[model samples]
Target: MSDKITSIVGARPRGHGEAVARILSLAAAPTFAIMALIAAAAPADMLCAAMQGPLSLQGMVPMYALMSAFHLAPWLRLVR
Candidate 1:
């Protein structure tokens, strides 16, 4: 097997590039998740004032949640 396979069987050791990719993938999920949490806890007025115009937790929470969700594939790949 080449140095990219991550399966349980016939898996080869990871190369330097692959290792960096793995590390980044692992880090991305939590980073976005933390962003979502911070967004959820932030005051709506503060966000609105910073961004200008109308903004609310209702809009911000789900958008961040979706961003975090979109970054979850790396975690899923690790599980499999």
Candidate 2:
């Protein structure tokens, strides 16, 4: 049984690099959106506390917006 399983596993088709890239791109979409929303809504003080007082959440929103825009452009192209 183990030999049979191993044989089947070995016979399984391999994915192309593009497939992995697409999967990763899709996975990042929602994460970027969520991060954008969180950064936009989170208080700067809270972010500062979480970052041990080095970073500010006020800056997070713009950064997240840019990241979200970067992710969104590809998705929009895919959708169209």
TM-scores, all models, native as reference = 0.59, 0.53
- Tens digit of per-residue lDDT, candidate 2, span 5-32: 3343343324544454555676676787
Q: lDDT by residue for model 1 over 1-63, one digit each (tens)?
A: 343345532234447566566667677778878888897688767645676544544566667
Which regions of candidate 2 fall more than 4 Å away from where they truly are?
1-14, 46-58
Deviation from native of the Cα of residue 62 in model 2, angstroms: 1.3
On TM-score, the candidate that comes out on top is 1
lDDT for position 17 in model 2: 48
- Among residues 3 or more apart in sequence or in different chains, the pairs in candidate 1 whose N, CA or C atoms overlap within 3 Å are none
Would you list the C-alpha lDDT of every candidate in the order shown?
0.66, 0.61
Q: Indicate the worst ten consecutive residues by lDDT in candidate 2.
A: 5-14
Error of 1 at 35 (Å): 0.7
Worst 10 residues of 1 by lDDT: 1-10
